[model samples]
Each structure stands twice: as C-alpha cells, then as structure tokens.
Target: MTELARLKFYATQAHPCSYLPTEQATTLFLDPSQPMDAQVYAELSEVGFRRSGDHLYRPHCQKCSACVPARLPVADFKPNRQQRRILSRNADLQVRAVRPAFSEEYYDLYARYIEQRHADGDMYPPNREQFSTFLVRDLPFSRFYEFRLGGRLLAVAVTDVLPNGLSAVYTFYDPDEEHRSLGRFAILWQIAETARLGLHAVYLGYWIKNCRKMNYKTQYRPIELFVNQHWAILT
Candidate 1:
C-alpha cells in the first residue's frame, strides 16, 4: 500500500451519496496531474481505487464506510443455476471487445436505457457529452465490449484491462430486453474472460449491503471486499 500512500489525493466536498440517498459521501481522488499508466493504475486498483473518466478515486467519507471495494476472485468463482441459465439465454450474443470510442449505436442504446431505467438517477436524460466523458477515455487499458444479437447492439460493458484483472467500470444495456438479463450475463462473461486471460480477479467497484442496487455484486461467490485496509473473503 506504500504505492497508494505516496500518491497525492484530493477529497471532494461532501455530497449526496448516489447509491444511498440518506447519506452524504466524499471522494478521494488521485492528483489530476499525476502520470498515470497501466502499472500505476493497477497499483491503485490493488489498494481499492477505481477510475471514473480521467480520475482515479475511492469513497473518502468519514462517517459512511458503506461503499466497500469488492472483487470476484477468478479462480474461486462458479456460476450458480440462474447465472448458467442467463449464459444459455445469451448464447447468441456476439460479444466483441473493441477500442473505447463513441458509437452512435451504443449511445442510442445507452440513452434509451437511462431514460427508461435510471430516470430518477443522476445520469437520467443522458446525452452524448455525458456518455463520452464518462466512458470513452484515452487510456491504454480502456476497452468497450459490445454484446450484440444478429449484428444489432444490445449491451455494452465498459472495462479496463488492469494488470491483475479486468475492472468492470460500468454497464448499460437495452432496458427493453430486461428478460434477457444482459447485465448479469455480462459479469459472468467477464469472469470467464478473466480466467481466459489468467488474471486474479474482476474488480467490481463498491458494494453496500443495505443498498439493493449495489449489493447484488455479492452474487458472485467467493468475492473479496476491501475493508479496514485489508482484502478479506466476504461470503
């Protein structure tokens, strides 16, 4: 953790917590001017920091520690019945890992998804600029993986190819195809892909036990949580 300790961090003023509205949250981010590369990013990731746009950050709230960093240990993960069924359901999706750049097709699906499913959230009424700033970064590790059906895009998993594992930054899909559970399938696929790449784990951002939207990350068995300055099994 010396690597993280030596880096400069700037804390954001306390703001309303995005996941838990009942609380206020602050974020600790790496110095914007810091020279960031894959190795540096991986070191920070190992210590629970995550990337958002050009910034690498983590929850820095004094009173609220609900946003615990979570990761799925690749070697220990095994899909359950429902996850297997989801895999079977999305067997036809042509998932392709392409460079991280904006695509009108991907944006259309993203706009529709936020409009319908996240209308009450901050990212509601999504626009091109928001999508570009949030996902399309000029980073060496950034990758945009698309899940398509018969050449029509259905979902996108914005990931980073970290040294130790893949970081699942964000995922948006066609809200119309809720039955397909593309979101769940995408995580499962990342786990398999992590194994294929001989990585250690999948860095799932944060998990809050009381937050339904965030807590679902625990569904991946043998997941590890960074708490009290250490990574430990949470299951």
Candidate 2:
C-alpha cells in the first residue's frame, strides 16, 4: 500500500454545523499523534478534508453534498484591478511568516474579529487555551503570517502548507482597522504568498452558495470547485 493509503481515520460523531443556517453535520477525527505524510494530507484535501482547529473534517452527511473543496490555480491566477487596488491600499503593511505561536495579541485580534464580523456566530470570545487548541495544536505543518503596520500587529493569518497547496485555516484582524479592508487584503496576500512559494494551488476551504460570508471568495476569479470528485472550472 502507498503511504497516503496507510494513514487511517474514522468518523467519530455527528456534531453541530459550523456553517449555514438550519443545517447539521459531523466531523471525522484522525490521530494527530501519528506522523502522516504530506501526500496523505493532499489526498484527504481532494476528498474534502478541511483543516479546522487541528482537525481535518468534511461534511459527511448521507443526504447532502454542498460542502465541496475549492482551490485556486496560483500560476494562472490574475490580480484584477480591484484586487490590485486592495493590495495597493495595504502597501505599507509588511508580512513575516513565523512558526505558529500562541499569544495574547493573536487572541485579542481573534476576539475582536469574531465579535465584529460574526457576533451571532458560535466562536465568540474563545479563550486562550481554546484558541491555542483550535489554531496551534496537533498539526504537523503550520505557520502564521503576521501583518504589521508601523511595527504594530494589525492582522494574523494562520495557514498550513500541504504537499499540493496552501490551505488558509483562519485569519483575524484588528477590528479598529476597518478601513484597511484586512479580510480581503489577507486573501490577496495568500495568493501572492502561494505564487512566491511556487506552489500550484491555494485551497480556500468551502464556498456555500447562499452564505454571504463565503460568497466573497468567489471574487477570486478562475477558482476550480470539486464537484462529484472532479475539479470543475468555474466560469
């Protein structure tokens, strides 16, 4: 058997849904202690395993197939006028990739973002321990891209670089810097970072049709979606 096929995991339980309204779902857990190869992760990603809080999960509903893994071809990716403007607007900001670390600054930014952007969402005020477990724990490869403005922390994006591509796990920004368009800027940074690393693609997790929060991801044109286990290019 191949190395990727040897890594085994199973679905544990049916849990509450993190996205969408009136929908329920469950996550399949894997042994984080094991040394799974990058090829294993790539395969899982193609199969719709999204990295969430140190866990790789896909919507394993018997009746639904809405949550599909979406990826962007970094080589073919183009920065349109608007995306270029967003990048230009944040020209003063600098990025430094560092090993994932738990910090009060990160937690503070996360709380502010959650409260402001997703006030009614379930992940409000996540404590330090929970935040560490969720963001920094149990992953083989993880990093944080710190966005600094005048040497001040304005945003931090946590990501994982898998074999096939980079997966954007999560991002939080200083709510006070609303004018900077931190959320959109962060994604543009990811695309540039992927290109810099010579990576082929950047996985953008899921894009639900009706979720406005997710709809914006579609703006990153020329994204390919996994439909029925095939990568379908979106027009």
Candidate 3:
C-alpha cells in the first residue's frame, strides 16, 4: 500500500467536551508511531485534523456534530468594518515570523495570558513543559510569529505552514493590552500574510456555534466549513 494508504486512526473514549461543558466528546487521531509526512498532513488538514504537539487529531464525538472545521479563503476575504479597525488599531506593532524556540520571555507572556484569560480552562496554571510541547515542537513547517511594540513583546501567534495554506495553531497575547485586541489582530495578520504569500486559505481550526469562545470565528466572512465530506460556504 502507498504511504497515505498505510495511515490509520484511533478514537479516544468519551470525555467532557472541551468547548461545550454540557456535552461529551471523543477525538480521532492518527497513529503516533507513523512518521509525519507533510503531504499526508496537508491532505488530512483538508478533512479537519489539527496538530497538537506531535499528534494530529479532530473532534470525533458521535452524538454531537456541533464541532465544524473552518477556514478562510484569503483571496475572497474582505475584512469587515470591525476587523479593518482591529488591523489599523495595531498598525504600530511590528510582526515577524521566526523559528520556533522556547524562551522564558515567551513562556512568561504565555503564562500570564493563560492565567488571566484561561484560568478556568484546561490550560490554567501554564508550565514550561506544557508550553514547550504544545508550541515549540521542531516540526519543519512550524513557525512562531511575534508581535511587538517598540521592541516589547505583546503577542505570539503559533502557526503551521502547510502546502496549500497556513494553520493557526494557537495565539496568546498580553492581557494587559486588552484594547489592542491582539488575539484577533494576530489572525487578521495571518490572513493578510497568507494572501501575500500566494496561499489559498488560513485554517482557523474548529468552531462550534453554541460555544461562545469558538463562535467568534464566523466574524471572518466568506468562511468555508468542511461538512458532510465537502467544503461548503458558510458565509
């Protein structure tokens, strides 16, 4: 069989849904023993899988189809009034894509972000190992985008470079910079960068309409959601 043909998937047992606490969730993931192939990874991405550390996974809940994979077609994206304002608001912040590495500075920013914004979530009380493993993996396609103002760190957007598009793995910013809306700014920047690089889409991972934290993804207009085995326009 071909390399792609050799792929296999396993589903985890039911557990509390991370997005909606009222539901149970399961996840489908690739075999950890299989070596990661970029082409294979890209293909899987088209169907909704995402990378977490060294593994690729997606929500596999049987009873709930609320979780829907979403991506933005960069060329067709038109920043809404609010999004354009978010971009213009943070115009002073310098942005750059650098090699992914673990630094106390990044970790400190991440720790503070989690403690303030996600203290009630699973990533509450962030530590070095969790930070390193989640975002600092040595994958060839991984990149860390640092947003700074006058050389002071404000946010870090962890992204994955894919064959056809960019995947927004995660983003964390200074809670103190709440007016900057750094998290939303990071995604807007990525969409613009993806188009500048001649890419097609920016994968924003999954969105569940009922989940307040995830529903914001719809603000990016002209979104295409992978549903019923095909990408359907959700605009």
Candidate 4:
C-alpha cells in the first residue's frame, strides 16, 4: 500500500490594512516552496481563501464583510439583451490559450489599461518581473487565456483551475479599446469557458455592493454570495 502525499504550510502575515478603501482586509502570504495540496486548496476556497498563481490567501481582517466570495452558477446563467450586445460587439476577437509569459505587447496593454482605468491606484505600473510574479510566480494550478484581435494581442486573463470550478484571478486589457468594454467581455468569456468545461461555477472574487469597482459583478444575474459564512443565493 502507498501513502498519500501531504502539503505543509504556515501563516506568514495578516498585516493591518485593507485591499479596498471601505472594506477591511488581511492576507496570508505563504512561503514560495511550500507544498500545495488539492484538498487543502478546496477547503481554503470554501472558507473564503483565494489562490493567485501559487499563493493561498484569505481575508482575515476584523469586522469586515464587504469582500464576500462571489460566484456565478453556470447552469443557470442567462445573458440579457444588453449582455448579448456586449458579446456580439467583440465577436471578432479570438481567444488563445497559451502558457503565461511576459512580452512588450502584454506590458504595454497592461500599462495603458492601468493608466487609463486605474491611474492613481495602489497598483503602480508593474515592471516585467513584477508582472511575472503577479501572473506566474508560484502558480500551483493555473492557465493563461490570451485574447487576440486581427493577429494583435488585445487582452489576457490569468485563471486558476480548481477541482470544482474556474477562478478569474486577474485580467488586463488594451485600454485603447475601452469602448469595446473588454473587461465585461472577458468576464462573459470566463463564464462561457466554465460552461464549456462542464464546470458548475465561475468564482469572480469579492464583491462590495457599494464600491464602484465591485459593482459590475452584480450585473451577472442569479449569483451567489458568501454571507454569514454560508453560500446564499442573491440575484
């Protein structure tokens, strides 16, 4: 008989600070070389822990419920007329699944997006290594979804493939095409990807109803929110 392998990790820090202004937040930074176990990842996710590349993190701040784990039920998802328009507008774009990599094209698109969409934000323009660290670094289970238009790279979405469903970890797009609503389109693509893979849910991270940046998530109907430490259906 063979014994199953185990993963070992310890908490590093939950610094007193918040990721969003109105919400309190804390993160547990894991050692780079720590072993990652499937059961542990799944368990952590249910408890509000999120995986970014190779890091396993959860919100541990005091008395803050703004960052609730938001997910969409793929089976019950229905694109309204407006959402369908957004999809059709980007119909010409092509999605290419490639291994994560850093390139002048990707960086330029990211910079433009940040400058136009998130200027004066906490995330300053990241250098190449920082971008790699943010996107690739210690990824235990991840994939890169690259979007191209007319042979030109338009956007990229880094996702973590979990046992139960897909998680949209981070996304960046060509800010030049803001009118195309690339961010919204990327989300729709994620939901479609989940359905194609026969997955049940698409985890969209935290959603703060009052925050402008988090409000877009609510547009997806028939969603579920983690409330009172339980998954409750919210439309």
Candidate 5:
C-alpha cells in the first residue's frame, strides 16, 4: 500500500449552505501554511478536494451530504443534442489560453453576470477585491481562457491545470449572450481542451442534486461522483 503524506486539516464554523437554503454547511480545509504545489493539489483533487482562491477545501457538513464532487472521464464523454447545438452555436468564437491576470473587461463581464443573473447568490454585488480574491491568484498552473467573437469578449473560464486533468474553477460570461449558452460552451471547450492535452478528466467542483443551478452538471454523461470515500460512475 502507498503511504499518503501527513497533512493537517481544519473545519470552518457552520454557515448557511450556499446550495440548499434550509441547511448549514461546514468546510474542511488543508493547512494554509503547508505547501500546495501542483502534485499535491492533483492528489487532493483525486480524493474530492476543490480550490477557491488559494484555499483547498471540501464540504464537511455534519447533517447533510448534498454536495458531491464531480468529474468527467474525458475518453468516455459524449455530448448530447443540446450540448452539440451549443457548440455549433458558439463555433465562431475564438478561444485563447492566457496567464491569469486582472483585466477590466473580464471584471466588467463578471460584475454584469453577477448583477443580472445571480443577484440573490452570495457572489452578488461583485467588486474588484472579491473578484480578484475568487479568480485571480498566484498559482503556477492556473490559466484564464478568453472567448471572443469579432474582437468582442464573450466569456472567461478560469481553469487550473492538474497533473491528471484540468479543474473548472469558475466561469463568467456576457449575460446579454444568454442565447448563445456561453456557460455550456465554456465547459465543452474545457472538455475538448482536456482531450487535446491527453488528460484523463475534468474536475467540476461540487454538484448538489437539489440545486437548480447545479443540475446542468449532470447533463454531461459518463460523469463520476465522489461518494462515501469512493468515486462511482453516475448513470
């Protein structure tokens, strides 16, 4: 048997659940002082850990197990009709992978997305500080994928490159382009990028069954869910 590294973990105080309003949520995070390199992060991700800014954490709620870590096995992935249409619809957009840096245009799109689409969510009233803390951070393997059409920015996907695959940290797009389904296209692009890189999977943070906002994650077939200390294919 392989021995894992000894690491310290801390749990946050109970807070209102972000997905399910009726429940409380707690998070288990690795020690901040410890080194968090790409190798360590990849190991942690295989066991269902997720990164927010510089913190690596996972839900540790005592009363509920609604948040399930999800990942897509790239080799087995197959897009449905709707996802295919979304890809074709956004085919004209150009994608570029660049270093994660603060940009006014990206921030503007993010602010508008939060203001118009997610006013009731926690990230509403988005500001520069909050945006920087959430998406822009000092990570060697992180990248910002920019989507554009005719020189106009449409979406930005913040992704982290792990040893085994890519991790979808967050995505924000022009709310006015809702008809283009930019969010779905962003994920599809990530999937294609993962395959292009010959990676194994794409880690999609957490999927809550009861949350309407997260239901779309299940639409990607051949997805595996981390449950009861194991990853099982969800049919």
Candidate 6:
C-alpha cells in the first residue's frame, strides 16, 4: 500500500444537511496536512471521495445514506432526446479550458448566478472572498472552462482533470440564459470532452435522491453509484 492508502481522515460534527434539511450530515474529510495530487485524488475518487474547494470529503451521516457518489462511464453513456437537444441548442457557444484564476467577468456571472438562482441556498449573498475560496483554488489539475458567445462570457464550468477522468466541480451561468439550460449543457459538454480524451468516466459529485436540485443528475442514463463500497449501476 502507498502512503495515500495509509492516509488519515477526520469526520465533522453532525450539522444540518444541505440536501435534506430535515436530517443532519457528517462529512469524512482527508487529513488536510497530507499532500494531495491528481494521482492520489484519482485513487480516492475510485472509492467515492469528492472535492470541495481544496478539501477532499464524503458524506458520513449515521442515519441517512441519501448522498450517493455518481459517475458516468463515458463509453457506455448515451444521451437521451432532451440532452441531445440541449447540446444542439448550445452548439454555437465556444468553449475554452483555461487555468483556474480569479476573473472579474467570471466573478460577475457567478454573483449573478448565486443571487438569481441560489438566493435561498447557503451560497446566497455571494461575495468575492466566498467566490474565490469556493472555485478558485491552487490545484494543478483544476481548469475553468469558459463558455462564450460572440466573445461575451456566458457561463463557466469549473472542472478538475484526474488521472482516470474529469471531475465536474461546479458550474455557473448568466441568469438570463435560463432558457438555454446551460447547466445541463455543461455536463453534456464534459461528457463529450472526457470521451474525446479517452477517459474512463466523468465524476459528477454526490447525487441525493430526495434533493430536487440533484434530480437532474439522474437524467444522464447509465450512471454508476458508489454503494456498499462498490460502483454499481443505479436502475
């Protein structure tokens, strides 16, 4: 076993669950002092760990197992009619993958996204500090995929490239572009990019069964869920 295999983890005290408000949630986090990299991250991801900012963690709730780690096996994925339409709808948008950095244009869109779409959520009342801490981190594998139309920035998909595949960290878009379904489009774009790069899968964080916000994840057919210490297809 490697050093990562012997890594220590600490669990958080029970707190209000973000997905299910009625329940409490505890998170098991990798030791922050441990040096982490793409290789170690990929190893942890295979066992259902996820990254939030610079922290690698997974839900460790005692009473609920609603947050299931999910990933798309790129080779076996087939987009449905609606997903295909989303791709066609946003076909004109140009995508560019750049290093993760603080950008005025990106931050403006992020603020608007949080204000308009997630006003009631924890990220509401967004500010520069919160924005930077959440998305802009110093990680070698991190990338900010900018979606532009006629040179105007419209959306950004914050992704991390792991050894095995890409991890979809977070996505934000112009509030006015709701009709375009840019959020869904971002995931579809990642799937295509992952396939083009010969990756095995696209890790799409946790999928909570009872969370309406997470229901969208299920639309992507043939998603594998990490259950009982194994990756199993959710039927």
Q: Estimate each model's TM-score.
A: 0.97, 0.92, 0.96, 0.87, 0.97, 0.97
Tens-place lDDT per residue, model 1, 32-110, is 9997678888888877899999999999999988888999989988899999999999998898998888889888999
Colliding pairs, model 6: none
Candidate 1 lands at a TM-score of: 0.97
In every candidate, how many clashes are there?
0, 0, 0, 3, 0, 0
Off by over 4 Å in 1: none
lDDT of each: 0.91, 0.80, 0.91, 0.76, 0.92, 0.92
> Over the stretch 1-235, how does candidate 3's per-residue lDDT look in tens digits?
1365668999999999888888999999999987776777788888899999999999998899998999999998899899989999999999988989999999999999999999989988899999998889888898999999988999999999888799999999999999988989999999999999998899999988888899778988899999999999995
* Candidate 3 ranges beyond 4 A from true positions: 1-3
Window of ten residues with lowest summed lDDT in model 5: 1-10
Give the per-residue Cα lDDT of candidate 4 at 34.
59
Alpha-carbon deviation at 49 in model 1, angstroms: 0.8
Worst 10 residues of 1 by lDDT: 1-10
Model 6 global lDDT (CA atoms, 0 to 1): 0.92
The candidate with the higher lDDT, 2 or 4, is 2
Tens digits of per-residue lDDT for model 6 on 115-213? 999998988899999999989997999999999998999999999998799999999999999889999999999999999999999999999888999
Tens-digit lDDT string for candidate 5 (187-219): 999999999999999999999988999999999
Model 5 ranges off by over 4 Å: 1-5
Backbone-clash count (model 6): 0
**Root-mean-square deviation of each candidate, in angstroms?**
1.3, 1.9, 1.4, 3.3, 1.4, 1.1
User: Residue 154, candidate 1: how far off, in angstroms?
Assistant: 0.7
* Superior by TM-score: candidate 1 or candidate 4: 1
